[model samples]
Each structure stands twice: as C-alpha cells, then as structure tokens.
Target: MSRNILRHWFSVLVATLAALAISSNAFANTKNYTVTAPDGVALSVQESGNPLGQPVVLIHGLLGSRLNWDAQVGSAELQRYRIITYDLRGHGLSGKPTEAEAYRDGRRWADDLAAVIEASHASRPVLVGWSLGGAVISNYLAAYGDSQIAAAVYVDGVIELKGDQIVAHSEVYRDMISSDLKTHLDGERTFLSLCFHTQPDRPTIERLLANAAMASWDMQSAVQSMTVAASEGLSKIRVPVLLLYGEHDALVNTSGAIARAKQLDPQIQIKLYANSGHAPFMEESERFNRDLAAFIETAVIH
Candidate 1:
C-alpha cells in the first residue's frame, strides 16, 4: 500500500481502539464555553481534538446542536486539527428568541458564527458546514468575506433554501412549527428521518430526536424566510471550497446545489457519495473524514 493509504488505515485502527477504551458518549479533553453573538444571543460552543493544531469550525444544520458533529470531532484522523462546534441561536443549548426578526435576518446568523470564531481565538480556521449550516457560511462570507478563514467544506449543504434546489416537504415543515406538541414532534422525527438513506440505530435516532425537540418553534417558522447570500458570498470566496453531497439525498437537489456552486466559482471542488443521502458525513463518515483531512492539508498550505 502507498504511504498515505497505510497512514489512513493506521489512523482508523487507532481511532477504533481508542473508541473502545472510552465512553461512546464522551469526547476526550473537550472544552466548553458560551460565545455571545452580536445581537446578544449566547451560542453554546465546544472545542475538542488537538488544541494546538489548526482550527476547524463545524456548523450544524437546522434543528441540530453541536452534537451533530460528534463523528468528525471524535475521529482519530481528524485529531491533528482543533475542532469547534456550536449551537445556532435557536438550537440546542443556545439562547432562543421568539421574535421573527432574529431568525429572518441572515446576517445575524453570520454574526453569530463570527462571534464564536473571534471568541475562540481561532486563527484562519477551516469552516465545515452541514445542511442549513451551508447557508450560514454563505451569509458569513457575504458579510465578512474569507479573510478570516482558510477554507470551507459543505457536507450535504443547502446552497439555497428556495426554488427547485430544495426538495418539497412543505407539510413536514408546516407541522414542525405546529402548536400541538405531538404534531410538531412527529414532524421533527420525519424531518430527521429524511436525512439518511440508511437510518441510524434506535438509540442514536432517539438522541437526535431529543436535540430536535430542543429547537425553537419560532425560529423554525421564521427561518423559512431567511435569505441565503449564495450570489454574493460564494462568488467572493478566494479560498478553496469543497462541496460534498450524497447521491441519494432526499431533502436537497444535489445536482442543482453543485451546479449553483460551480456557476458561482468553477474552482470549488465537488464530491458525491453514491450510497448516502442528506447526512453523508454521518452515513459515510470514515471516507468523509479522510477526504476532509486531505482537503484541509492542501487548504492550509494554500
């Protein structure tokens, strides 16, 4: 085997053994804190992996907390880099505002990300955003530009929230914000279910359901109208960009998202996971981590 391939396998083996030795639910040497956004929203943030290594900020999707990045944060191959994960304004342990203005304005989301980056003292961190997280990155780039970061990776990311790019699931979205608790919970379950081609274990699903349950109803309702700065943001990024999408995605038109991203910047890299769906980072995490590590190596150098 090639030296790189041997190293990859060695890392996987070490990670596997390390996982067996530690509790499955815990991240070792994790540091947790709260970063206040520009609008006074407190974002719950966590840092794991190698603290002294290059930083990587991980932004989760709608209805997801920082826990959504457990796979990436816990990987052995990824341990060489500092990993940062945070809860969005209306998600997880973060502050949740009921007002429509807080969720409708995309700049607020971007500012929240900036606040986390600034507070963490992360120098030129690589941004890895998933699903709705992609829109957050776009808005951030539009508002602040790419001078602060090294590179970006969008995993099954949503390029735009409207038009043919988004898969139609209007009823599920409507039910998500329903006043009736059962309807709302069921909607959340269905929405999470759509994220995978092969569903996770019952325990994992239950945990994710709990995470979704913690999300704000007002935010979910208002986020539908949030602006995505694809034209302004994607076009302006001078740093390397990679789009990793699943071939079987149920929630997004992967081809359309890729097309839009390429139209904005032809230099952006693209990778498709043929057997996976909306959550390819979770569905095919080993390969995803390997690919991410390879990209970061080149990104940091550039």
Candidate 2:
C-alpha cells in the first residue's frame, strides 16, 4: 500500500475507535427502566455505574425528580457503585394519580420505594434521601422495616416529622403547601432560591424550575396533609445513618434537625457543607460526591 493511503487508513481507524469508546462509555453508565409499585403506579427508574457493585438508591425531595441527583449520578466518584435514582409518585415521569387517596398516609411512598428496590435486584441497598425524601425513607422503615436497607443518608431533609417541629423549622414548607396559587408560586421561587448558597448557573436553575413545575399541587397537598411522624421508628433502623445538610440552608432549620437526629441515634454520622444551602449535592458537588463515596465504602453493608 502507498504511504499516504496507509496514513489515511490509520487515522480513520483511530477516529472510529475513539467514537466507539465514547459510545461504550455512555452506554455503560446509564440504563433506564420502569418499575410498578404495589398500588400499580409505575416509576421511572435510572441506574448507572457497575451493575454488580454495591447498590445506592437516591430519592429526591418534594416536587423534585431523579434529575435532582444528576450531579451524583454522573460523578466519577460513584462510578464504582451501582447507583439507582427514581421519580417519586406524582413527581417527575412517575405515574401521577390525581385522587387524594393515592398519596394519603405515606404508605404509597413506602410501596413505591419497595418496588424500586425490588426492581434493582439489590439486597440491602443504601438509601439516600433529600428533603421530603427523608420522610419517604422514614415511612419505608415504618411500613416495610429497615431490613432491606444497608444504610441511610438524609440530606437537608425532615428526619423527625412532628407537625410542630416541621412548622417551626421550615416556613418554606408552609409556603409551599399554601392554598393560594400566587402564594404557592412565590413560595416555590423563594424555596428554589434558598436551595443554594449562591445563585446556581442558568441551566441548573432552569432544570430545577422545570422539575418543580412538573409536580402536581393536589398530590403535594395530599401528601403534606397526611404527614405521619416517623420519629417513632428511628430507633429500629439497624444500619448506619449519615446526615448531610448545608450550613447556610435557608429552607429548614438544619441545626435543630441534626440535634434531634443525634438524640435519636448518637452513632449517626453528620457532615455540614460550609457554603451550601438546601441542595448540597448540587451546590457543593465535589465534596458531596467524595463524602458520599466514602460513606458508602465505609458504612454501607454489602
């Protein structure tokens, strides 16, 4: 073969190989699936990383979806572990039943989580909950028990669901559940703004807004109305617990909640992000990802 022809062929092969590598890496990191809850609601579930590695399930807060954990999902720190994130009922791409009964009492939340766990084919997977997701994890413990959970991570969330405590700790919650549309929208805007210590980039802000808008107000109200205190079952969780919160969080009283959770389980680990607010994972992603990987490595049971 001519030297010029040989060089051209080699370059073409190199480019083809690079493209194949890129495609393979993308495919290896993301998988989407649908799982049915006990009540017949279907959830949109996404899994990434090594499928056979230690499983970690991430549950997003109220009016949030799996996208809330996008930073963690795509992080290289979590690439060694199997990561599962799903939209809660009435949130994201998950099935939304308009009936009030569907979201009543938080049992459906537990069932939905159970279904996700079952679908992941993971035994005793670590549970990571942010904001209202903490309530879902607590409810899961109350309904299904913690036998299936290897560990738990509560991120700027409500660990103790006492009505008085909730009211006192978060006026944001009050605003979010308000009856007036203007009040609700205003509250949501404020709530999103409070989620970060500094203003997030425009793309991140837009994504957050889009997810918040997708949530059904009626379903949210129903869930809020039926809030059951999960404090009673905190003592029953046998696995390690990690509490993550932002120091500058304007949404919830992070200090009070951490103090309360410590009283319940003195052994629980706590990490406060110095400059972050409600969404530490989004605001301080590098530190959050590192800490999370460490926690899963040292704490979570296989």
Candidate 3:
C-alpha cells in the first residue's frame, strides 16, 4: 500500500520549472537589527535585496543561523525580492535562553517568528523553512494561522518528531547533550555530517561545524522533545505550500514525511531531489534556487 502511494506520488510530484529571469537592476538594500520577542529573547535579523519588493523569510534549522541561507540570499534570482533571515532563539546571534521551557514549548518558537515578521514590517511574506525550521513554521501556523503569510515552503522539513518520520541516530543525539564539551562537539559534528549526502567544501563544513558549536547546550537538550503541532498547524493552512525533499536524506524519513504531509493537506505540492540529501538547498543549489524562484513568482501572482 505504501509503495503504491509513493509510486503515485512520484508520478504527480512537481518538478522544477523553467528558470525565471528576474533582473537585479535595482540597488539592493541591506539592513540589520534586533527584534525582541514577546518573551524578551532578542532575535538577530538581517534583510537584503530589493527593499520595495515582496518579502521572503528564510528560516534555518537546528544549530543553524541566518548563514544557512547564504546560497539563496546571494542568488541573483532571489535578489529581485526582499529577503529576510533571522537566527532562532538558541542559535547564531540570537539570545540563548537557559530555561527548558524556552525550547520545549512550540508556542514560544511560534511567537518568536511572529515577532520577527511584525518587527520587520514584512507584509504577507512567504515563509521558507528548512529542517527543524519546518517545525517552527508548523508552530507558527498553529499559533497565528495562515492569515499573515502568503505561502510556505518546507525544505527537507521535519513534519513530526515521530519515530517513523525521523531517522534514529541515538548516539549522536545523546552525545550532543552530554555534559562533556568534547563529546557534545563531536556529536554536533556527526549530526551536521548527517545533513548531507554530498558533502560540501571543506570551508563550508568547517564553518557549519563552528555554527553548531555555538548553539545553546540547554536548547539542544530540550529541543529534541519540542512540540511540533503538525495537526493543528499544517492541516489548517489555506495558502499554497510546497514540500521539497531530497530522496537521499539521511536524517529524515523523506517518504514518511511526504506521506504524512499529504494526509494532512493533499493539496500541498511536492518536489523531490533524487541526488541530494537533507540540505538540498546547499547540495543542488542551482536547481533549488530555480524551483524556489519559480514558486515565489507564482505565489506572489496568485
């Protein structure tokens, strides 16, 4: 039965469309500031690209920051729109809250996203989430609904934390929360490695490892059990949604997530990258950017 569903799904999956030639003639504006969430966690936010164009918010996954969007932010295709990226509470330049509740409650993460959108004055921006950031989008939709956003894209998103949907790397997760620094860092390195089927360049790997090291220990320990709110969030979205997944993903059960997402919202579009892994945006960037740009264009139009 599952095989049949997958076979049918593959037949109908949306492939990347012809690239959109969006000109970057306008002078792109870059801005940086801090937005304080209702709970007082200061989020580091950055904006680039046409200041007057439609907004696109790029949310990174666990242990990742705004730097994760370097490929998209720097792409000429995306430069035609206003691009926004921000670090989550426990990552990058954002405030790292020590309390367990800060990481466990899904609402706090949702509130943080809402705060960033409101603070940035992004009117009906399209939300794009990667990995754990996908869960953040789910939580945001649950708490705030789909009224504020124009569309949503989930790149290798974690649909739920269920055992079937998530690939088990027990030792890596356990060591990540270990009290010893070496053990924790080693675990983080291993976890980051699992994010790709085609490894990135040496410098990219090293920089991402450093990003992992800077994450809040408390947040890492608590986020494993964070509330996902998939039922309340995903099922309720009325706007367009695109689920982009890599077939070779090592950290997530790609087929399972796709199946679950379809069950929730059969209308949601699906796209699969056969050669890439968890981070398709980084692995097959050119194609990913084209698909994304195409989606953004269609979303903005209708």
Candidate 4:
C-alpha cells in the first residue's frame, strides 16, 4: 500500500465519521459483469481497479459477493492488479436457483469460478479467495488442474467441517444470513465496532455493511458441500497456497489452519494478523496488501 493511500484512508476515515452524522453513505463504485457457470447459471462478477493489469481474480466468502471486498478493490494501489470479484450463485446479484440441484453439493459454484477464470483470459493469473471462496478454489484445484493459476491466496476461509458439525453450525451460519437484512446490517455495524476498535470510520464501516447486506443467500447448499469438502482430498495440491487469516477470528482458528497447512502441504505459506477477524482484507488492509504484493512478486507469472 502506498503511503499516500494510507494517508487518504485515514483522512477518509475522519471524514466518514463527521459525515455519518449528516448523510450516511460512502461506498465506492463497483461494476458488474455476467459469467456463465458450468450449470448454465449466470453468476455476477463485480470488480474495480485496472482491468488490463496483471490479472488477479478475487472470490468472496459464504453469503458474500464482490462487495465484501470493496476496500481492496477500491484501493489506489490496486492499479497494478486487475482485481476481479464476483457473487457466487444465490448471493448478491448472481443468478440464484432455489432448486437443490443448482447448488448441487457445491460443484456448481466452483465451476462458476472456472468459467470466470476462462472468461477473464488471464493466463496464469493469481486467485484471491475468502472463506467459502477458499473452499471453492480448493475444490477447483482438486477436480481440475490449476496450472492456470500463478498463485492462490486463501483469506481466513480454510478449516475442516463435517457430519454433525454441519447441522451444529448450520444455524450459526444461517442465523447470520437468515436475520432480517436490516438487523444483520446493524449487527455488522456493531461488529465493526469490535473488528476495528483501533479506528473504523463510519463510511468504511457503512460501505462494508452495505456490501455485506447485499450478500443475502440460501447457504444451505454451501453448508452441505463444504461439509463434504471438510474431508476432500487436498494433499495432492502442489500450487503455492498462501493462507492469510486472523488470530482472533472465531470461525476458524489460526493454529489449526497453520497445523493443517503444514500437514497438507509443507510448501504452503501462512500469515496470521494479530488484530484481524474474519475480514482481514478490511480490518488489516495494509498488511493484507503488503503480503499479497510480496506473494505476487514471487509468483512465476507466465
């Protein structure tokens, strides 16, 4: 991240707080495109930054879309990275088929990602996935070849889930998604309070919640598929996997992920932000961008 952008963010943070009292709105613009998933569903791909730069495909979490990645997408430093993001089916502006077959245990979502990669025409591009997006990339690599990906970045979204744990945590994930979008928005407001005790300005926080609230979905399908992925064969993965997460993120513990990464692929790299939660990209944007740039620099982009 450039020092200028850092200073601008701080200024924006202060201005957002002051303006929050008058008019509560400060979201950067996000553009959308449609990509056909393998299942024939039109998934929505949202994006920002330079489109002609080194391609960087971004994936969001469960019940999330490109909007969740607003801060990074809107950052000035992104000029060098063509940051692409999208709404998985059933979330945000993507095509949502209620049929159980659409979600179909999760293959459809991963396939959608594949189509997006091909559509972008990004040869050996870097993939940045968050939470559910992490699993999607994992499944993508497992089912097909990832020689097209120069590197894969998993942001706070790798852990194992299975059997009873699925039912046990369904409500947890569902309730968060099932709540009145309004109340959920409010909750995120409070969540930012904690996630950014250091200094979460109103605009940054509002934009975050707004983008998040737009990510409504029927996650039951992800629940089912991810449960299966909890045990999916990932030991064969040879591509560079860089996992960046938080120390206090309740959804997935860092120690467990670090241990799992080592067990799965001794070649993997891991970084845990001391003051981050589920949304490290937003909470610790500087560190996140720094690590990401370093990783990209190391990647042998073809």
Which candidate has the highest lDDT of all?
1
* Better by TM-score, candidate 3 or 1: 1
Write model 2 residue lDDT over 216-261, tens digit each, in one string: 8877678766654466556677789999999887666887788888
Please give me the total number of clashing residue pairs in predicted model 1. 0
Off by over 4 Å in 2: 1-28, 163-184
lDDT by residue for model 4 over 1-302, one digit each (tens)? 99999999999998777644322211344456798887778888765555566788888876456766766665554546777887887777888776766664656666888899888777677888887777777777766657677888888765455331111343444345444766555554454343432456677656666655555345543354443242343566666778887776655655766676567777878888888877788888867877887788787542
Off by over 4 Å in 3: 1-29
Specify the highest-TM-score model's number: 1
All candidates in order of lDDT, best leading: 1, 3, 2, 4
| Candidate 3 local Cα displacement, residue 283, angstroms | 0.5
Better of 2 and 3 by TM-score: 3
Q: Any idea what lDDT model 4 has?
A: 0.66
Writing each residue's lDDT as its tens digit, candidate 1 over 125-219 gives: 99999999999999999999999999999988889886668999999999998999999999999999999998998988988999999999999
Name the 10 consecutive residues with the lowest summed lDDT in model 1: 19-28
- Residue 249, candidate 1: Cα error in Å is 0.6
> In model 1, what lDDT does residue 278 have?
95
